[model samples]
Target: MKEILERRYTLTPFKKEIKGLKDAFRRASLRNLDSMRKRGFRPKNISYYEEVILGEKRYEELKGFSGRIIGYFCTFIPQELIYAARAIPIRLCSGFYDTVLVCEEILAKDICPLVKSSFGFKISASSYFELCDAVILPTPCDPKKKLIEILSDYLPVWVLKIPQDKTSSSKEIWLEEIKSLKERIEDFTKTKLTRQRLEETIKLIHKRQTLFRQLYEIRRANPYLMGGRDFLLVIQTSFYDDIERWIDKTEELCKQLSKEKTHFKTDEKIKILVTGSPIIWPNFKLLNIIEDLGAEIVCDDLCSGTQSLYNLVEPDEPTTDVMLGAIADGYLLSSVCPCFIENNDRIDRVLNLIEEFRVGGVIYHSLRLCQLYEIESHRLRLILKEKKIPMLTIHTDYSQEDTEQIKTRVEAFLEMLKR
Candidate 1:
């Protein structure tokens, strides 16, 4: 019993060897800075990403503070509730290549790389990982579901259930689940979820979402002003750091974009909408190759991209029940994940983004072993065919060895699109 409990929270001998991996992750991200600069991306505007990507800055700041810090995997987990309980909720998703290599040895080499990277980071004792008082994991897909089962063996894990479909009946069930999660959060933090506090948190997060929406709109309206790489980094950074600062920086970025009449010759570049598994920062190989091959990703429906921030939490009534219900429904209805099969939410999102951005082509990127997204790409292909929009689907893993192959395919697709 003592051995099992000890193993649940600490590391094994191999994981201990990589305890201080902050520099490794930073070096990996900085590998592309020169290329980004050559492409005219603003380095100053993205300084926050470099500062907090490894969690050293925030961890240092909060080291003396006595408060619970919850790490969660999916966006489906309601962050407002965590904030309401006076606890911080940080996203624990991963994109580090070294960490994924470490995880593959223990968690099977064939699973999703994102899941492996996340678990590997946790086991490696990242400062951000160390600050996690608990982990809230939700099962929107199979890899994540199994990942949490393995993660619970090493860390304190709380599983939050979500509905697989967007039926009225399922939405009601999701509401109950949200309420249950609130209770779990409250139990963890020993703080009560008061009506006033819940309302305040909801408005606070909704305000941030509104600014994020503005940034999303400006990307399509002014593609030359911001590239997909910077936009994705900003969004990914917001997942794990200070929410207010993210809002301010995003607002500042949009303000600068709206004022500047940045223009680029669009005759050669095909406007494309990318949809697939979450592409976190530093893993921007696909976007880089697409743009390099003469395509402008004006907007994307990917989980890590713009689609997650589309819905606002608006309560029909000024009550805790109504507010919680609104928050739960917003995620259920606006979610772009293909995990929701009984409805056409994913199709609706893709078609809407394509029309809204005037996207000429769709690049459906399904990461290897991510069965749900891969399965849904076929349906999206049929839907795009009916609409007479061109598309290319690519199944890829998180390795740069396939970069040349992906770039070749993207180049060929761009040629067809231009014709």
Candidate 2:
């Protein structure tokens, strides 16, 4: 019955009018990149991250690469498995508002902008979507579950079923799913995922996660050593950047940060912690406004931010089954995504970040039509209120139509925090 419904949705005719989207998207991307570049105290090695974020260099490099490219949506898909299979994993979550407009022709006007932008890139064959030999999608939400059907029409789509409840039975089910995913990836890459290769990849990703933690620690410096927008760009680049290169570049950036000293006093700027929906690059309106108003975003609870790198895969043994179980636990159990029915983990994470970062205020960014975050915000707000921590929920979409309005509201929130 589910398959029947998916097939019906897949039959919708899509007229791909992609004539000017590429150039338009490029201009918008560069414009946003330049805007971020001109702000705050930027590190000398920041260009390395900028180039990676732009993706032109990586795109050229991949064009001549020998391995198959596998694109996946959501961090739930284990990248270590993709590496073990000798396939490159590229995250397909997009933040381009122009692509959202392009997608509106095919999708409903009220769909989540992130989903629309991602599908838009695929339909137009823009960005790295054209390079993907296959794509893996996790069924974490209704939009993404339906997305698998529409995306199947464009490329080979593999669905990774995510169990909503974090129970022992669910863990067992997820482990089986991980094993199934490993088999599918091996078939796609025509490479056997040996125990040695999986272990090697797990260790390699652990190195990358370690570097991310180092950068996170650097951000914890008094008076703020780095701006949140810059840190976010660095994290977002990990979506497509080479793992080894990303680690090296990030380490270099961290070392540069360590040698520097900030003249900005801690009391001069309010330290704000941003939580809720992922704030992908190029759609950094909320972040830009927060910092431009003189508040430092010391920490965040965003999946696109700290949550993606906070957990490590610690297998009890180097055996493949145990390693896969560890990866399953790392992704599912540690995740605070609102998709789960019980997400007190998210509240706890928020309170912890507030205390750790000395957050003066909390900003909950809810993307329009993203029901999960919007629904979760109410409970989050109530909990934050009880703790006497202030939280401002900004509900918005990808378009700049609400930019001034958001800026105004954020200015008011920062003022209240000061008082």
Per-model TM-score on C-alpha atoms: 0.92, 0.95
Clashes of each: 0, 0
- Score each candidate by Cα lDDT: 0.78, 0.85
lDDT of 2 by residue, 1-419 (tens): 02222444445446476787767766767877766766667888988888887777899988877889999988798999999987899888888888887888878898989999998887777788889999999988889998988887777788889998899999899898888888888877989999999999999999988888888887776537778888888888998898888888888888888888555454457989999898887788888888878888889978888887877988889998899989999999989999888999999998988888888999999999999999999999998899999999999988889989999999999999999
Error of 1 at 132 (Å): 0.8
**Which lDDT value does model 2 have at 69?**
94
Q: Could you give me the TM-score of model 2 versus the true structure?
A: 0.95
After superposition, candidate 1 runs with Cα above 4 Å error: 1-15, 41-44, 62-64, 262-268
lDDT score of residue 10 within candidate 2:
47
